[model samples]
Target: MIAAFLGMRLYSVLGRKAEHEEEIIQGRFKQEEEARDVPPPTATGADSARVEPVIAGFPPAIERGLREISTADRNFELIGFMEGAKGAYEVVLEAFWQGDKEELRELCDDDVYQSFAAAIDEREAMGVTLDNKLIRIEDSTVHSAQLDGKIARIAVIFVSDIASVTRDKDGNVIAGSLDDAVESRDIWTFSRDIRSDNPQWLLDETDIG
Candidate 1:
């Protein structure tokens, strides 16, 4: 019986079916298994595999054009155009307050500037001040940019909250509080036409009404 049991354990160990139970059975007859089980070799390209970098195509001309257009389009931003608008608004607002048509000649559109200036003059003749306050930018977006010939017409959507105030020449606020802001929106199109003599950037026109 002992020999038969020892023979069975040896057969199981040689067949690679020597579990802890087989070891116990063989050890009972003072026999040791030839080899112990070990984990399988790790498969290559399984975990932590390095990936190859993808090659991207390059179009130099198209890339350059896109960059140039992006740079020109930046002029329609709030802060960028705000500087010019602030200056223009200051002149227009003061002229409107004083009713000075001559001061708005080169600063604004002819008809609109003249009409606004006339109104200011009429009010000033009556001892009135038109307090125009530029409050906050409600919305701003680039409407369109069309490249025509060698020029680009960039249209921008400008919207803001403005408080038009009225003061008595003494600098005393008579009407319209700073809190009295109203929504005002407009589409301003600026044209940049390439020139031959200058060969530089120039503002050809600004839509005003």
Candidate 2:
């Protein structure tokens, strides 16, 4: 996971899928389940049966984009990016819950920052506090990826279990059960300016599935 505050520059700052559709917004918030039955690349290179760079699980277009990303950013690694996404997910949730605009600023784009800030403000104004916890990240996968001009973006799906509870100023249980962990699916897009010195991929957009 990223730090409580995103102060690290480059990769640490901006670095980091779903089911149901025809259009795959590689960098936008869209959903579609591709050929997931295909397996990932295996470690057993001696066996000629293993495809070195497996493309079985990804849709063709997305697979092509992944190749482009690798060509564009030598530092890009599918596994590393997946792990980074997990951390970023946790950081964003914690920051949003705490209404930490400073932390959000470094991690998300201006529009997203404004949206989260507004939501946090509204929740606070209502004299309500949310206690949210990420119980576990069950799965993570890429839904789409693309490069527009010098910008590169990838949308990912995070399957997770979360425990949450909301309380009024009087501390009365309001929404969500404190004891139950709810399953959730989130699609988020992260983008980075490939031509720039900045390595951070900002949180460009999000959608719930």
Candidate 3:
């Protein structure tokens, strides 16, 4: 009788401990489930009123043209396109000035390619070579834009400085600078068919200033 009583008392103590541990586990699970139900913090007050749009600092004509292009091409971005134009400016001039017709053909139109070829030929016949290096592009702005049917034409004005000098076949400085950088302004026009899949814009015309 005594042994049976002791065994029952031990079992009672173990049952209470087990129930206590089960209660702790259930409480933890409930806390975790409750935490998941809470919503993320809301951005209230002035934060809710802030809305950003494309900022324009161009002339009314340019702004209107940009809007037109934006309507036609949803992916067109002003700041990014301007930045790319600046890079293309450097690439095209670097190739043309160095008499790389193949590279020029990839960047410019047929007439532009022919003109560049003629200039290069003239320079070659004169037995004078040009050593030119772009120092920096000071500024670049879109002068105008027009959408004619499916084609989009944009004229950009680029102001740049370069270190350049002309030397004869025997290496004589004929013109320009070898050390000092000179500024050059060019109004370059580019055209592309917006409906086409090709994203490359061709250099159509240029006016030097």
Candidate with top TM-score is 2
For 1-209, candidate 3 gives per-residue lDDT tens digits of 32243224323321221111011110010111132232111111221112114426668887677667666755455555565567667767677567787766766666655666666776677676667789999998889887777667777888999887677789887666768997878777766666755444666667764
Using alpha carbons, what is the TM-score of model 3?
A: 0.71
Q: Put the candidates in TM-score order, highest first.
A: 2, 3, 1
Candidate 1 per-residue lDDT, tens place, 129-150, comes to 5567777666665555555554
lDDT comparing candidate 3 with the true structure: 0.59
**lDDT score of residue 183 within candidate 2:** 84
Q: After superposition, how far is residue 131 of candidate 3 from its true place, in Å?
A: 0.4
Where does candidate 3 clash, by residue pair? none
| Residue 5 displacement in candidate 1 (angstroms) | 99
The lDDT per prediction is: 0.40, 0.62, 0.59
Tens digit per residue, CA lDDT, model 2, 92-188: 8877877787767766666666667766776677677777788998988998889777677888888899887777789886766757998878888
Lowest lDDT 10-residue stretch of candidate 1: 21-30
Model 2 RMSD, rounded to 1 decimal? 12.1
**Reference-based TM-score of each model:** 0.42, 0.73, 0.71
Angstrom error of the Cα, residue 41, model 3: value is: 42
Model with the higher TM-score, candidate 1 or 2: 2
